[model samples]
Target: MATIKDVAQRAQVSTASVSRVLSGDARTSAEMRERVLTAARELRFRPNAVARSLRSTGTRTIGLVVSDLLNPFFTELTRAVEDAARAAGYAVIVGNADESPEQQDHYVRILLGRQVDGLIVVPTVETSPLLHEAAASDHNIVLVDRRAVGVDAPIALADGATAIDELVDHLVATGRRRPAILAGPDLAGSSRERLAAFRAAVARCGLDLPESRVIHGDFRAGSGHDALAALLTGDDAPDAVFVANGPMALGALQHLAEAGGRAPRVPEDLALAVFDDMPWFSLLRPTLTAIQQPTAALGERALSMLLARIRGEDVPDERLECRLVLRESTEPRSAR
Candidate 1:
């Protein structure tokens, strides 16, 4: 309930002087500003955000829209974005689309309605129209993780093709001829790119990947487990599997443990490689081999791009590289 007037009275200064001090007006005397700040802190005074936003035309808030909150990839990205935004003196509002176009559009409207200073989105393919509308409206919008088809917005993305190529090359070099892939939903922008790269790599290696060896699943642990079960139970089980994300990799591992089936034992029966370098991956039973995306850097760079756009600066689409991390799960065939 403490107000600016209370702080001004406690500091023995006028309300105008307190306002100047709080706003960081350079014209205010340093000694007076310190006194007002000390009084405000002692009184537990909080500024009226609504009034301040109305006056300054800035809410100091950035909206972040992600496809899935449960995925560790997005969770880590969110943490990084929140931390970077806080350091830059902005608050973040996160919205999960659940990979649904309707939900994505709903959150977009809500964020705009709330008058957030800017938006960063991992867009669904169906929401491209909505994104285009927002972009045409002159709203500050930046794409993160996924780029839209027809919309031209500042973007931050991983090099999906190169990452997948590296994984394939490693598998081939390790003496794994029959390789399977568990890919995320093809509608997702990043997923589609990964699938394309995977196919191209297989072709270049003079390997033919039949439709039976590829399974499509949502980027969830359960989906991964189910996909692996389906593949292993079928007639043609692969000598190696490349899972696109961390959760899927874990799920596949879980299924392998429970099935008690023979062949493709860790590094011997079947080698495993996946995307995303999760914190605990290195400590797992076989210590997973992974293609590590710079997730923290991706989140930080997305925030920086958004902030720059909010400041009226022009930014272009960007792609960050992925590093391959070798571990016991993908030991050379001879060593196994």
Candidate 2:
């Protein structure tokens, strides 16, 4: 119920001064800002965001529509974005798309409807019409961790080439001759990049990556489970596998833990590694060998790009490097 005028009176400052201080205007003196803030806090004064946004174009808030929150990669990325945005005096509204194009489009509509100053989208695929429309309309957007085809926006993503190559080298040196990959949906940008890097890595080590070894998953546990089940058969079954993401790695491990069925003991019968390192990975009996994406960098970089675009600055896509972390899961076949 407290008004700006009430706080202004308490601080003995004009309403205009209070407005400037509350809006984070740099022109406000430190002493005046402190006085106004103290009075406002004492009075429990809350700014009318709707009225303020009506007067100014920027809401001082942006939206982040991510591919899926179930994946810890996105969860960590979200926290990073929140931290950077908060430090820059902005707030974030996060939308979880759950890897559904329709859901992503719906969230886009809702986020734009809220008049968000800008948006950072982890696109579901390259064919999202709304993404194109938003770019064409000049709505501020920055793609993170993935790209939407033909969306003329700056992007911040990961380049897993070097890490994948390193992973392959490690596997080969450890005697994992026959290695395979459990990839995500083929159309997804990250999936395509990772698959390419993985194949190129295999080839570099004089190994063959048959199309049959490239099993596709939906970046979820169930799909990962099914993909592993499909690959674990016949004389040609792979001796090693690299799961593309954390959830899929979990599912693949689950398949190996089936209660009554014969399961291949890891590093004994099979070797395992994964992309997208998670905190809990180390807790597993045999810690997982995983690739760690520059998750925090991705969030901070994407948000900075989005903020720059909002400020009428031109930005370009940049890719961060990934790291291969060694753990017990991919130990040498001889040691096992």
Candidate 3:
């Protein structure tokens, strides 16, 4: 197998020079670094990341554990993180937790075992203690999108407070009296944050949001379908409803279209709004109103913080702001 020695010989340099170049030592001249890298690439000489990490030189990689791959927000987060990580001259190892606490813990353990330099995780609801223990042990952990229940790690998130207020005020001005919410899972911290923001906005706008109007879903399309169906069948159905995510919003639209006699047309029978803005949302018969979070910025900031933490730097939490985009579904465009 090709080794550092082979690369060193190919580059006409000593093994120590090759090591310095491969370890990202800034002292190495750019010409020497290029020569070493070209030789390593030509020889297909791969470094033993574990061995390098044992010597405290790092694997030159970071691990990212996503909350759920199905969520478009997370998909964008992954892309943004990859772009930032690559630009920083590092590799990324990604793990999909599927929004399960057990799966999240398992992936975290695997990533730690792989000896990645640091971790960027989106904590699941009721996450296990291993994560907290790792953070306490100084494993260079950083939370993305939401804070864990007990982990005291640095966090990066997107705040939707102003957008929620704008949505509520817009609804009130448009003559909508009753508004409801199709919320995410009750146990998730992020879900609670969103619910709290919506509730506060409703109260501030002088709108009534009864406990019965809050329907919890599992942040999936199917659960959104069922939740919307329940709300629509209730004795006092809402005149307007807010969906917490893109997939759920699409699912609720499906239920609305197929409810036969109970079906409510967008902005006419029932106005609809959502927290996440997707490209396809604009192409729907009635474009959806949505709040667009700075997902790319959130992901980039999380990685930047994680990298700093890996370098033994203390970092503060970050909260990016979101913007509300009103469209036909909210009667802003007056499509009907």
My TM-score estimates for the predictions, one after another, are 0.81, 0.83, 0.83
Question: Candidate 1: where is the Cα deviation over 4 Å?
Answer: 1-56, 261-263
State residue 89's C-alpha deviation in candidate 1, in Å.
1.2
Counting clashing residue pairs in each candidate, in order, gives 3, 0, 0
lDDT tens digits by residue: candidate 3, 257-314: 7886669877887889999899899998788999999999998999999999978798
Candidate 2: minimum summed lDDT over ten consecutive residues — where? Answer: 12-21
User: After TM-score superposition, what is the CA distance of residue 19 in candidate 3 from its true location, in Å?
Assistant: 21
Among the numbered candidates, top lDDT falls to 2
- Give the Å error, residue 294, model 3: 0.5
Candidate 3 residue spans exceeding 4 A from truth? 1-54, 332-335
- Full-model lDDT for every candidate: 0.83, 0.88, 0.85
The residue-level lDDT of candidate 2 at 156 comes to: 96
In candidate 3, list every pair of residues with a backbone clash.
none
